[model samples]
Target chain A: MINTILCIILAILMISIGGKRGIKSFISLCLNFILLIFTFYLIACGFNSVIVTLLGTIMFSYFILFYVNGRNIKTKISFVSVIIVLILLTFFISLITYISKISGFGEESLEEINMFSYNVNINMTNITVSLILISLIGAIVDASIAISSALYEVYENNPNLNRYELFISGMNIGKSILGTTTNTLLFAYLAEFMTLIVWFNGLNSSFSYIINSKVFASEFIKIILVNIGSITIIPITAILTANKLKNTKE
Target chain B: MSKFSIQRKDIVIFTIILILSTISLVFVNNNFKFYTSTIVKINSIEEEKIDPITEPNILGIEEDYYLQKITGTIMNGKDKGKIISLENERSTSNVVDEKYKKGDYVFVSGNDITGLKRDVYIIIVIVIFIFLLFIIGKFKGLLSIVSVVFNTIIFCIGIKLYTNGLNIILLILIESIIFTIISLILTNGVNKNTLSAIISVIASMLVLSIMILLIAGITKYKNVNFNGMSFLTVPPEAIFTAELLIGGLGAIMDVCITITSSIKELIDKDNNIETRALIKSSRNIGKDIMGTMINVLFFTYLSGCLPIFVLSLRNGVSLTNYIQANFSLELTRFLVGSIGIVLAIPISSLISIKFYKRGDAR
Candidate 1:
């Protein structure tokens, strides 16, 4: 009952203020509800969450990206490439996590979580891998795709640009976009980790543990994923977005 | 562009980074142990003193403190099973809560319970963080802190409810909404523009949320192995919920800022431009902002986990296990959020175009 009331209030408020933002937000909200429901249902239905998750990401990404506006084929292709890159991210992150088996910082928060799963005899590796894969995903994919789309659209306006010339321009612009995208995550995470890192530092334990420990391990995974993910996404998106546009532009 | 060379400023920043890295290495050399405390008899009372080496057998590697094996209950977390022995004390960690007693579930990371002395380094970090935020954000930072405080209170309550094991999904939803409100209200304000920003943020967040659950369903990602986490602040369930909520917080703020600024820019420029123009400007604005937006997401996450990366490199953890175990859900949260920002450029463009169209039509 309370949930219904809350939902109603949220609906009214969203509608009242949603003026300039469009009802797309409403669509998003409903989709989110569905996501949650689907999550529950999948858990119950005994589906392989890994594949479900991939499909989910695609579905949501599609909604979030194209629901409000249309994109050309190149843009869609670029988006797909980002997904392809994401799949690689998943593979790499899981593989690393599974292999390293640092116990993720022995007694750290992750350890505690994994420990609970241990009691249940759950495969801690997969769970941790999924969590890790998704961490840097939002920002990474957002930045790359946006930049790719922008670069293509920008280049489309310049008919003098050949493929090579266009790639150079895109790289230059992509670098600029990449700079801030990096900082947003950098500062925010820095802001949150200020204390945690310092605490680690003060311990004056061998620097190795700070890096190798589970807590640090968890963070390391996030960074590497972002680095590899971003690096791969950029080139892939640039190539894909600019693909065949050589002729399209002239 | 100014000659895209390694400019003086770049050099200076690089040097600074080098310096910070060096300092970090010093920290690494020192093992990053900050807290300093040891379980001892009441000021040399000697009666309570036990074989320090017996406790925290792991302390053999700890350069920081003497071991003291003492049994106590963990006042918090899944380890509340019974009195557990504790030994090593690091500045970042603490001993069992005061109420901890033998036969009471307790897991110790620091020295004996009562949380021996805190490491001087942690205190320093706390002091530094406070000063930095206050200095940089000024009154707004203070407000941010207040916002954090208030949000934390709510988070506490939410977690408390979750600890009791209620509706995890509902809790996550409510928690996420509250977090969004708090984040927007704190950073932007309770104004129309803020509301617009919230809508933009919420919209993207909704998208990300959908993706998360959908993937969870499709991938059965939620069937996550719930091992090893029975010792944290809350049960695995609550922790997982909190993890998602907390993980999403930074991205929420990121999107909110991007949208808010873009809209503000649109409204400022004559407020009479074609929706198309407003959108173009928004995309331009997003274009300008994306660089720093994504950089911090990558860096912040990476920097926080710097030690882990370093450790992975040092210990030679296999590429596969390292990436899988090391990468966190928060990183995924960033990916999802960044995607929103990327997509938001077009979405905001469309909305702003319509925003103007509506005004002109009316």
Candidate 2:
């Protein structure tokens, strides 16, 4: 009941305050939510999670960039950069998950899931990589879009600037954005970690034990991976936007 | 300097980090002596049996399970260099059980395999992250890293006090203020703009807490499900509030600083700019930021719930029941967080204006 009320209230606020853009933001949120549920459904129904995540991320970036922010050079460049970064990140994430064997539910969740059968024939490693990818896509997309759009605006106002200068400007802009962006990502994950930390503290688990625990390690990895993706995209978006703007002007 | 020269410098940094990380990985893998439990380096594994569980469990799903006979030598502790044989069982899903291959390291006490030695992976990532921070942020990056480490330590200490019977809401409130002061000063430095942002964040957070309390009071927190946190021994209400206070602080701080800094830039650019124009410009900036921040939080909070959501749904829980059981908490977090982000915009603009005007007077 409270959930429905809160949703209604949030919806009303978004529409009223944001006006047209607000309504689109609200719609994008709903569409993305449904898409995620569908992705999980496919994975649960025995489809390849990695493949689903790939397709899902493509559609997600499309919704986030073209649908919410609109189609433009900025969105196009951001879309391209996001896809590129995600591809590179996929290889890195897969390698790490394979080596760490950090997939599957952790010991902390065993109490809640003790009654369920674990015989489902799915690669937990793949699922872990997929989860990490899903958790990170939003932040990456958000950061790239911010950079490309901000760079594009700079290009518009200073059309005489060369590609090299534009690239430097983008980096400067990225530097400013980087601090708060990472902090936002970090704290979001930390919030999720709080309960688990409390649970561990309650049990009086030693520092080494908690640090070495599967659950804590997995959560910490997810945070770092997202930060990496966001950071990498800054340079990529800057380069792409700068190159694109210069070519179009010529 | 040529662009190629800059590229060369980057290459050096990259190669050095790569070499250092490799060395650290070796050190961490071999440093199992630091552990209290005996660490085993699995040298060989023989599959004992592949058994299909015939019984449909609570979720009405069956799976193929495996049993392995593992032989390895102890790598650390008092039993160093002793051969040990252990039996392990893992299912295809491997929800809580790990599938060990030859050449894997595991912690063991006597005959039981306890857990995987994962510090090597953590150390590698941390090393790379710190380097990346240095590469991108330079001096500022170093400070931000320190602030993050400090904030994490402070958070742990706060949790310790909470477990020792401290009031969570009060504790987190104080911690939030401290975090804002320290992180803002560390990353942004001590300036009027930082001070303006600090005041703005506190103001918005104050309003946010009051708003949440009022809502919770009016609704009597009715239908606010605590099923997701059922294992917690403390009051879920208080813990959830603390989570909101701290979780929302990040986004609020982001919004506050962005507005505050942008306004400071505008004022610094044209010292005689009208207050009305400044207000309009900041609001426009705030609008763009608000949308993106909401989207970021939406996917972040919602994505974390997907695995558990799918797991529970497959376990035969209805969609409605699933939402009631697990998602309500996440939804509440997102909603309250979005409100905080939105609230920060006007509060920050108003505060920035006041602070800037005061500066003009001085």
Candidate 3:
């Protein structure tokens, strides 16, 4: 019921945004959703989570940037920069996941697992790691596109701006985006777990005890780790775009 | 000091509130009582055999599990600073039950002996999180922390009302509106930009709720399962709707602020710019942001569903069954929230255009 209503509403809103552009955005988002579900299916079918995630990230980066901005140099730059960041961030995400001992912290699902009554032979740790990695991709892609386009505009408006000036402009734009993006990520976790927090409080759990809970720690680590990726992309994308734009101008 | 030189006062007020809250949090006695125990030594470990008749396993036999004889010192309560011995069972699955080691802090209950409660690791993590936030955000970070504290109080009150049999949806709606206004004011101050963002958020929510209602009515609200969310007290549908409202608010607010502030900047830069040009530029900016803002909603909502997804897949459930059983709520939220963001772009753009034009008219 909600899906149908959402689809209709999205269709109307998309058309209103721009007849063709709106439709394109709607289709692109739908495809992205399908790709996500497909990625999970692949993972379940015994494909490696990391490889599937890499391929999925590349596909999503292309689809979102191309669909939104089209086949411009700006789109290409954002795509390449995002991929580079994703490659570098994957190792970091894995290291953090392993060190934190956050794998299989699904104690909340103990009841459901009992109800299902199935043999648990899967690597619960790998799924946890994959989910964390998957979560970072969206933020990284978003940051890359925002910085690349903002820098592109800065360079466009000021034709004579050199590489250094353009890079500085990109950094300034990135700095502004940092706070809200971080909040978006943090609040996202908060919103999902608001009830759990309330439950803990009602039970008289101390702030220390609540934060140290497996569920809470898993989420907190995920938020910080993903934000680290989002933050790193800013400098890397800025330098890459600045270099690209400068070279193209020459 | 000028009238606007209120930063020092704000800091002073914030500090006092922080100190008071911290003291109250630590010193106040909780309604439920627990014995604080400090692990002194792991005395011994032994394998306990379970009766095959009582406990059956996949191999048609009971599995042996380890039990540790743990000795600890009571740090608080009537047995303050007293040594005690407890058996820590190492269960077959470590996810459900945990094993304790020497020098670890644990909580225990019961008057006679004691039942083991959770460890005290979360407190350390919270301390680190707050310290990092303050160090990175400075004054702004301080304000954000204050806003979070206030918001949490509101949410707790809202939950209290709900458990007391108040309407959860209404409580959540009111709480969300209040949270939006208060947090924005605290962070951005009272201004035209804040007003525009607030208006945009409320307007988008109104439209989104109408869509939800229509959809709920049409579909008769089937497939809305609350099986996995066994923790909720109220009706599952009510909690789900309330969560949807609260879950979408942050992303929508973020979008609204970005669009409003960006458009405000453009209008300020060129006051004589045509309305058509302003709207067009706003749409362009919205296009640039819509992808990631929507992704923010998508990823965040999906993260919560990851556990369920893993559980279902591990159980060898089919894709369709997984979607029906696990992904339904998250899928609804992601779609509804994404649509809210989609609507927010134009809602914020159009409203800011009006606000700017009205300001110029004055």
Model 1 Cα lDDT, one tens digit per residue, B226-275 = 43233333334433433443454455556555666556656766756665
Off by more than 4 A, model 2: B1-26, B57-60, B218-221
Tens digits of per-residue lDDT, candidate 3, B5-120, equal 34675667557656765654464323124423332323333445443222433433233346666666666666566777676554443334454555545555542222222222
lDDT digits (tens) for residues B1-362 of candidate 2: 11312566566766776787788878887788788878899999998557664465556677777898999999887779989999898887776788899988888876999888888889978887878776776556667778889999999999989888888888888998998898888878888889999999999999988877777667766777675676676667778777877779899999999999999989989999999999889877876877779878887787777667657666776777776767788888888888888888889999999999988898
Evaluate all candidate structures by whole-model CA lDDT and list the values in order: 0.47, 0.81, 0.68
Which residue pairs in candidate 2 collide? none
DockQ, candidate no. 2: 0.53
Report per-candidate TM-score of chain A alone. 0.75, 0.97, 0.92
Candidate 2 local lDDT, residue A202: 84
What is the C-alpha lDDT profile of model 3 across A49-106, one tens digit per residue?
A: 7778788878878887787668898889989988888888778677655444455644
In terms of lDDT, which candidate is strongest? Answer: 2
What does candidate 1's lDDT look like per residue over A8-59, in tens digits? 5434433443433334454554564356335423422324545655665566
**Which should have the higher DockQ, number 1 or number 3?**
3
- Please compute DockQ, using alpha carbons, for every candidate against the native two-chain complex: 0.05, 0.53, 0.26
Arrange candidates by TM-score, highest first: which order? Answer: 2, 3, 1
Give the per-residue lDDT of model 2 (tens digit) for A70-169: 8988999999998999899999999988888778888777766666566556677778778888878878888898888888888899899898988888
Q: Which ten residues in a row have the lowest lDDT in candidate 2 chain B?
A: B1-10
lDDT of 2 at B257: 90
Top candidate, metric DockQ? 2
- In terms of lDDT, the poorest run of 10 residues in model 1 chain B is B91-100
